[model samples]
Target chain A: MTIAATKQFCTFFVGGHYFGVPVLDVQEAIRYQEMTSVPLSSSVVSGLINLRGQIVVAFDLRRRLELPPRSDGAKPMNVVVRHLDGVVSLLVDEIDDVVETDEVTFEPAPATLKGVAREVILGAYKLKNRLLLVLDIEKVLSIEAITSGDGDDNAS
Target chain B: MTLVGELVLARNQVLQFSATQSDPALLSATQQLNLLTSELQESVMKTRMQPIGKLWSKFPRVVRDLAGICGKRVRVQMEGEDTELDKTIIEAIGDPLTHIIRNAIDHGIEEPAIRTRRGKPEEGKLSLKAFHEGGQVNIEISDDGAGINVEKVRAKVLKQGLISPEQLTRMSERELIQLIFLPGFSTAEQVTSVSGRGVGMDVVKTNIEKIGGSLDIHSELGKGSTIKIKIPLTLAIIPALVVTSDSCRYAIPQVSLLELVRLDSEIAFKSVENIHGAPVYRLRGKLLPLVYLSSVLNTGSAQLNQDVASIDIVVLQADKLQFGLVVESIKDTAEIVVKPLGHHLKSASVFAGSTIMGDGKVALILDVVGLAEHAGLASKVEAIAASNLAGIQNDSTEGEKLLLVGVGDNSIAIHLSTVARLEEFPASAIESAGGRPVVQYRHGILPLVDLADFTGGYSAFSQNESPFQVVVCSGPHGIMGLIVDRIIDVVQENIQIQLIGERHGFIGSSIIHNKMTDLLDVHAVISSIDPSFFDEMKEALIGGVR
Candidate 1:
């Protein structure tokens, strides 16, 4: 009679997401071709990419999980992983493959979750019937949330 | 003193010549002091003379010991004693060429009966020459009599308010003898010790520019004063150009090199111009402004549209001020060597030493007037207040009809720095600069500005293959050319950048073959293309040619 139960998740769909990032935080996945924009950066980054040659940045993460605008047309896919000392890629709206098993498959995050995509998800995976959620991509690739409020420029 | 007492009396005339002879005229004065000590050992292996005429032969023996203590006669002529320099430039032109030949023989050679009514004759002529011109080394120094009196230099260029008797009646008797070299100044009329305590001609142009050199003075009223002096030929070999920006690489000097264009990716977005975000460059016809060596250091770049399509401006020049650096290419001119940078980098005024380069690496050099006085740039009224804070304006964008697009991924193009040519426009029409609509884009108003904030932003477009343009970016702080959506095939590729995040405002991601490419801050997009774009324009853009 020993059971605490409560952990089990696998979700995917980045930037429109069923969301769930942590099949051991990825590490390898490649698709986007040339990406290299970072000039005077900080507008949610979406720039530097070259995974195999190793420069990596590609951030968008659905504008870091405000989570609506995704298939601008689909061909860009990088995903890579790691971050910090190096390796970053995030852009995603496509690589859906891995799905192991977890803590009774999470559920405790409902109360409107505080906003800005609730800092990018932490618990929810109903599955079978279909809810998923979870994802936290290192606090959604952090840098104080891609330069926060951008001092102003949503205008477009 | 007499060449170290004639080298100990020519080694005591060869040790009192022991030919052990019976006084053949004291051994012919010791064989003419062994032929004057072998012509002072072949005049110390011929040429490069110094001891500047033994410091102007101790000033004609202190002007014949001050014309016998100021009864006055002075006569001193000495031309640049074989102009050899560096023994700390003959100990810095030996006391300002001896307080300018004792202020031209104590107040310009007058007495001898006031030089026979100032037609000047009684012993006047004091001289000194020192040549090697242009790459600097001059020395001049003249004198005749009286001179110094343009109504006492327009009453001392108007009692030192430094001009305005309508600028001393619009100066130029050689700018009225360079208003007697400013600093404290003195038209004499009294206070003397040989010269007024106003420390004569601004300490003779501050000790001939403390050895870097530049002093000018030319008087003529009663005809006399000349003082020239220029310096720089080798404080250790300089020459430079190297450049790289953000991933750092700097050097720039070919004595302020003047050319190195390159702009490729179809001329770096048609040569760049933003006016309202400042970054202009109409160039040959005039509108130049644009800086970005990485906005003084903010560093950035991981990718920014694969360097917007070719870049490498350079241009330099200094003295009258002529800017353009914009690099990521130009590499080689190096005669380098220099070294300095120590005393805690002599006040980091943007460096001027640390050379090494032929692959040995080091690099540093730049000072471009301490990086245009540390990027506030210094003048054309601080470059039209940094081109009206990089928004630049001469009425073009308002007159509308602007077209400079270049966005790749799916692709977008059109660039014309001023092409009376290259006009295609239909990526199915395109529209964004103001018809905005979440930008599926199309139908006119082509030109754009976000070149990562025009010239002084995107972390200073870090350059290597440097490029950036959220919009069409003309050049030099206004509109020079930067419409690029891919021309990424120029084949001379050879870079490295990738430091990873954080340093991304100027340089930290550029490695080509192993692959990483984001380095475009170009001084935060030329300071966001302009705040008013150098104003004074109810009329300039058409100068770039309608």
Candidate 2:
């Protein structure tokens, strides 16, 4: 009999889509707080928020993914994650529960998906309720698109 | 037991006990372990320390060889060689210390014959001392030879025309001595292969500052010259004050931080004034250039709202200039571990690096040097500000002498020293020559700079029957006449420059006879009329000083 390894993923909701990053890359989730806006910085850079004593750069996922911003007035959650660059906080509409899925269930991104979101997606996992799009944390935080001044967005 | 072994054991015990239910006795026992851990930490730190004598061991042989080459008889004395310093510091300071010693023997100490002729010992004494002061290690090198020749240093600087004669007249003897450290500034007449390839004290200063150290030179003619270098314990960690600007927290290294000031909204508006849109604060009777943190970071608008309740100002020293930085608030001070920024953000000039706080959030450490540059607080600007500061505090026993003149609707005071003569001319007497207004005076064609127009005032020339009164001002450039509406009077008052207005010809405003009078920058006015005026003056002044 063949067996598949079960991988855990930390998922969060942003702009009506559920996104998952490997649990190993996720640092922690904290409620969004006072963030000082850095002027003249990249547009996608929401601002810098002080998490505890450390200052973490908060990147707006909705803006990064080129999706519509949240209409609700509630403060978005911050999914603190680590990459080769340093620790960064991802701004999302809501935090979701961690899910474990078999590696066999992972599938490549569909051809219909396009733009930055599609480019950053590693693959998708078939879940009981919905499809969990796994994000390549490094590509999502690469900052090449904003810094390069292409002004290219996926949703618009 | 070894310090590390004890520390490791205590840490493991604390971790194991924390996993289970904590009793009062167990909690008290863990507190005792904390004390032991701190003691162990100090003991471990001692391992990286070594006697400074290890660094000083080679100085004697090197000094002897250098003195022989320079043809000078020198005696060396050492003290406090047992002072302890971090290993990294010892390694970094070795080369700089050697250079200073060579400079002392070659340039400072005179030859044996010259020393004997001066009625002193034939062998000049050079002393090398190291000691601990205020948590910093200080190394001093002193030579009991003919002190630095102030005249030679002055003549060299004048030949280069790097500083203006007007500036030279105001500089103190101590300030004149400091010029030797400037790059490419060698007072030596002959290029000695020993210490005079022109690359001298500037390199020494840079190397010392790189390791968080400072260098100072003190000298008295005919007595001796001393160079003191103070270095911190380590560069890996620093004590810094946390400050928030525009709601974002930043760390200012304690070394560069001078002091802090908090001003109420009402008083702040009066204390801080905007000159040509550049804010300046009057601190201790000196005009301090102010920069807003928000404005520099491109964050929220950096408007100094008149209606705000209060403001926080952090006074910081960048190089030699002291400036006040306006921030949102002042926070607690902490010992922070400095972390370098990611490569992508390395180009951000305002931040030296990022540091993780006690709570795990990252704070950007400000690069004081870069911030000063970005804000245009260059040394040249500082020199101008300093000279102007000296002019404002003209509390000489001779009294505060100023020439009062009218410009447009405002009356202004110009330093009497800046005025060469006063003249009057009718409308027909003023002639337009070379696209400038000139009037015949003494023996030459004197160019006229309109004080009103230069100070952003309305042109004073109109259909007026009254004669124009001109203040004859001479600077590094040729003499120029500043046309004014009227010549009031030359008065002496105890007034200090209370408000600094950024104008082409105006230095600041001061109260004269209970009335606010604008102070004029006569030198700047002449340059504004003819930018190359100083070039021609420089040749004449160089000849005069030589």
Candidate 3:
């Protein structure tokens, strides 16, 4: 049998879930910076952060994924990613190592996984330690999905 | 270009860091870096600058083809072809410029035969002139052809029911000519394949304004029309006024900023009054509407310093409507590089974009027009200024200028021509004389009439400790004060009395500002209060004649 091609992904953690975005899509990951709150924006839009000199909108992945609020005083790290519109930073609980997986262990997202996770999660790679969820970065950052139903559940 | 922007920001950070250092060598090096960075930035920006002639080079052919289609003989001329503009601005203005050229050939220029009959050259002259003035690029497109017909524009506006004939009469000829820029307004008696679907000029105006530019038109009846556009040198950077509200900073573009007014605690309390829940300030005899930035943004902050010891008002003009924006404080003005907001926050229309301040913090930029719309002030102002088109008509003789006032729940209009001045008298200063209320005025006793008594409405002065809003007018007897609950607005409207006087003091009722406003008969109201008020004046005049 022929061996499957390997794909690399930059990994991060939010709400106990391990997520991976294609390595090429990741711009950089840095410590949390001061954010200017947008008063009337969607709940998932954490705020605007100064990335070098560029103003990047920060999205809270916990709320975006419908998870409980982060513990008090725990600052989220920014996972800056290139978007078609501009650069946006996804606030995650912690950063993980880049993971490489082959198509042999890949499985499409289960039909039973419902709600927003069903939409943003492309598939999973069964790693030796745990399962790595491959995130569809485009769908995750799309403005329409971020603002539609269940988006405003935890905004306040 | 973005890399250059990043370099400039890095240099700024380094300069800021070196400011606290006492080392002379390091300080000198930082200064050298700052100066060199500025020079380098300027050089990089110059690389993007192209002579505007690059865009106009193809206009002659456009003019030729368009003139051929219109069956007109036109000569195209260009001046200042070497004048330069940013590449982006050159690209942005291309379509609008071409549209203007097409409009000139199609509608502006008369045919060759008509040009000869007018005793002029057989060919019409179409000139495009470009120059730099006041740190802006000025482009003028002029055509020596049949000029804009003010009469035609007025007739079209009337036919479309965009304005009433009465309002049309009050509009000046220049204002009538400008009506062509209104959306869906086309004066091309016939819709030709070329330019006159009524969509070009309005879009042209909006496109120019989007880049911090302004468009103006000057046309003569038979001479021609000149469309002049003034655009900023670049759109990447703009001068903005920084302000704070709810402890957060925001930037307002200087192009929309008219002026800044700071009112002391006492003046603020007295000058800012509430009219039907909307706060308005009497600015130099004009009623300027006020919008609180914190309230509009719903920042969850305590409502606008309720006790407002002092206030800062940023007077801004949005879409020709001027309003005062109340903020916590006014910071210094700075030239900021504008950056776009992410798609997540794009629906928040109040913010034009976000910018990084010198301290490396992101501050949202306020979109004046959007903010006004969000506050619901734009539509309100548009309704109140329905005849705003006649705002430029300073001729009071054309229409009756009325001072609209609120008396209880009713609105009343008093002829502004008869008003001597508007005065606010303390309620404590009121004294009674022969069962009539009066106040001591400029060394003489000025009789006061309660408008509520005439209209049978509740008196505001009697309920509160607030001062009486007195409209001072001079009759044959002398100046008398008419006490009203609140002073609404001064508008120049054609009074078409729809209902005759149904009450004692009201002359009649008319639909003013889309409301049934009673026209107050000042003489009758004064006579109802004091029968001898005008009789005494008559006795004095007869004595003088004898």
List TM-score (chain A only) for every prediction.
Answer: 0.35, 0.89, 0.92
Residue lDDT tens for model 1, A71-148: 556765766767565567677677776654456666777878887667667777666756677777767777666665
Tens-digit lDDT track of model 1 for B170-267 = 55466576677777777667785567666777777767754545577677767777777766654544457677765546677676567877677866
* CA deviation > 4 Å runs, candidate 3: A1-3, A128-130, A147-156, B1-4, B14-54, B75-84, B103-134, B138-228, B301-303, B343-349, B386-546
Selected candidate, larger TM-score, 2 vs 3: 3
| Total backbone clashes of candidate 2, pairs 3 or more residues apart or in separate chains | 5
Is 2 or 3 the stronger prediction by lDDT?
A: 3
Question: Per-residue lDDT tens digits of candidate 3, residues B245-303?
Answer: 87889999887789999999877878887665678887755668899888887764534
Per residue, candidate 2 scores C-alpha lDDT tens digits across B465-537 of: 6788889988776788888888887777666776564666678888876677999888777767667644544
**By summed lDDT, which 10 consecutive residues of candidate 2 chain B come out lowest?**
B1-10
Q: Would you list the rank order by DockQ, best first?
A: 3, 2, 1
Winner on DockQ (1 vs 2): 2
Report the CA-based lDDT of candidate 3 relative to the real structure. Answer: 0.84
C-alpha RMSD of each candidate structure in angstroms: 37.0, 20.1, 13.1
Would you estimate the TM-scores of all the predictions?
0.23, 0.50, 0.65
What order do you get sorting by TM-score, best first? 3, 2, 1
Model 1 has a DockQ score of: 0.01
